[model samples]
Target: MSATPSRYCHLIDEGEVFLERCRRILGEIQAAEDDLSAMTTSPRGRLRVGLAFAAGLPLPVISAFMERYPEIQLDLDFTDRMVDVIDEGFDVVIRGSELKDSRLMSRPLGPYRSCLVASPVYLQNRGIPAKPADLLTHSCLHYRWQNSGKLYQWPFKKQQAIQAGESLPVTMVCSNVEALIYLAQAGRGIACVPDFAVKDSLADGRLDKVLTNSLIGGSTFHVVWPSSRQMAPKVRAFVDFAVENFSKGLVS
Candidate 1:
């Protein structure tokens, strides 16, 4: 045993040296792997979305998206004016009506119907319009967009007889939908508002619909984004989530 001590000591020293080399190589490999992963990972980005007041009815869907993607920042601007998403740097726009712009990519989410409504007090005070022609004799609430420089016309399904020749008459004009509804609630005039806005009022006997036969056809709400590759991942993810959730009847 005493004669073998030198050989045993030499072998122990070599084994320790080999382990030290193995550890150094593994450390270098790990560091290299971490650097590679850092290069491949995508950076977080901000997404801004615009919505019309009518589109706010689906806030729950938007909120769910927020919960799912906490890393992405969301900015929402609510207005009726059609915003230029590219010029203004918005990533997405949720519009209340069918989109017609050729510069953007749009997907229809769902449709919503409109009803002509007046407060019962107004109906009692000024009588209901029997037909579209009868609206000429009543006070009307008009929404004139401030920026668009266009009047939001009251829409109705016209009979084949009058579709070719006549247009509905307007008596008074306002600039905002909420104000128009307020004026109608105050018994000032009649308003053509979306059913979502007035459903509770209608159910609670605060508002009554008029000209049911001439109800306005539904408007299709859409999700729009610039048709460009520059769109970030967050924007695309949010848009996909919205379309899915809205289609599931989770948001209306």
Candidate 2:
């Protein structure tokens, strides 16, 4: 005899629940397999990392990491844009901004300070900025934010009050920090940049610090990854390596 209509509906509901249970069981089994594999084998897989543009820490860290783990291959993406860790399939992302996503985990690498820098020629020709207000008259190389398309603010300590529509004189604008550094080194204009990126230049006298006592923009770099029940071996290794290397005050 044929089942009643309500009985058919009940069967469909039961089947749906059964499929869901099966899917969940399969997921658990896969997770267990992954954990077992990770435990048994060394970190030897492709690791995708997202890095901020022109952050000085990547070169040394990447070189050291590859030397230490020769089996693991690295895929690096460098950009100033904010990346989605999980959705973008990045195993790790290093950024100078604070973490906002609750689904991700972060480890602080170190702090970096920003300062206004210019070539000696530029300073001599344009005159050194005695204070933050003097920047209004000097040619400024500005950094345009990749995500917001707005100019990066020159965070100066004890900033003076400005008139209704006063702003720094912008001679050029670019999104890449390295480009700004290059231009500043070429005697183009004064550019605000992370101090670590110009350490050698400052030491060799290729660039001179401007408004040294007034600029106060700095932030800590963080290595971020997706939150998981068991962190992958490759991700764990890199995180530990980064923390150890950066703890030595290498990045300034």
Candidate 2 lDDT score at position 30 = 94
lDDT score for residue 19 of model 2: 100
Q: lDDT score of model 1?
A: 0.76
Write one digit per residue (lDDT tens) for candidate 2, span 1-252: 376988989999999999999999999999999888766678879999998756455787788899999988999999888888999999999888767899999999888889889999999998998877777888899999998899998887745533447888889999988899999999999999988888888999999997777866588889999998778889988888988885453454
Q: Stretches of candidate 1 above 4 Å error? A: 1-44, 101-103, 160-172, 229-231, 247-252
| Worst-scoring 10-residue span by lDDT in model 2 | 156-165
Give the whole-model CA lDDT for all candidates, comma-separated.
Answer: 0.76, 0.86
Q: Which candidate achieves the best TM-score against the true structure?
A: 2
| Leading candidate by lDDT | 2
- Give the clash count for each candidate: 0, 0
